[model samples]
Target: MVRPVTPASAGFRARGALVAVAALVLLAGCSADGEADAGASASPSSSVSAAPSSRPDPDAPLDANQACAAMYVDGGKTLEERIGTALVGASDGLDGTSADQMHAMAMELGRLEPRVPEEFQGPLEKIRVPFLQLQEALDLADGGQVELDIASTVAGLKEYEKLC
Candidate 1:
């Protein structure tokens, strides 16, 4: 006879499964074939990523953008040097919310995706509006109501995390 899984147990198992998949995708994206890697840094280009030893630890809990942000410290650069480059190569006509918008944004992400090689596109792709929301929350956080701002950002990020 098959045993039933409690929601708590099932939820934990599901989360573990997601974490494993994210790790695998992260691994597959590495190795840009070197020649391409050397070309960008030598000129004005959008290739962005943290140095390997300096990469944001892929294992940090999803809630900790702070930890990843810290990797940006130390006078170094990230795989996608700018947030726009990190999100999509060209914003061009993109603006605001729409179903197709997210995928459009993600389509441009290929050039920049390997920068944050540890992330699966699933998590990053979900950031379309939530990322905007998080930015608003972070900006608002400076108003001395930091806790509220963080709460808002976390809520948005949780929404993004749901996609993963």
Candidate 2:
């Protein structure tokens, strides 16, 4: 006879499912041709460009307006758009690929932090923290922490949105 599921058993099953999904996401990132999908980085609201003008000044400090301009450079995905794209992969739940995307984005923002106005640094850190935690959870394979990380990410995003 089939037995009714207990809370502990249900939690175990959920964790197992999360692991399976993470594995699938990792595998799907690779193709038979050995090239990642180009569209993977494209956001609905922005396009990727390799032009020199599309790049931000790596060494120069920027005022708030300049920092916002750098952050929203045309032909490159805006921060909001990038986050949205990453979240699309996390619609059902957080997976390795999504976590990696967010972590990379956070790293990119960190690189820009030194060049940004002091007023913007705190909000940028707020955005980066949850993304970092999300990746950490994935790295540790802590399925239970993924939900909390995702929630934190969304909250952080909301706070950062008030800035630019």
Per-residue CA lDDT of model 1 for 1-164, tens digit only, reads: 11111212121122332333234323322332132334434432332444535554544342223223322221244322332232221122223432144344334343333444354333344333333432344346442211111122223234333322
lDDT of 2: 0.48
Query: TM-scores across all candidates?
Result: 0.21, 0.53
Q: Please tell me which predicted candidate would have the highest lDDT against the true structure.
A: 2
Q: Residue 2 lDDT in model 2?
A: 12
Taking every candidate in turn, the Cα RMSD to the unseen true structure, in Å, is: 17.2, 12.2
TM-score of candidate 2 relative to the true fold = 0.53
Per-residue lDDT tens digits for candidate 2, residues 18-53, read 343334334332221122122222332253445635
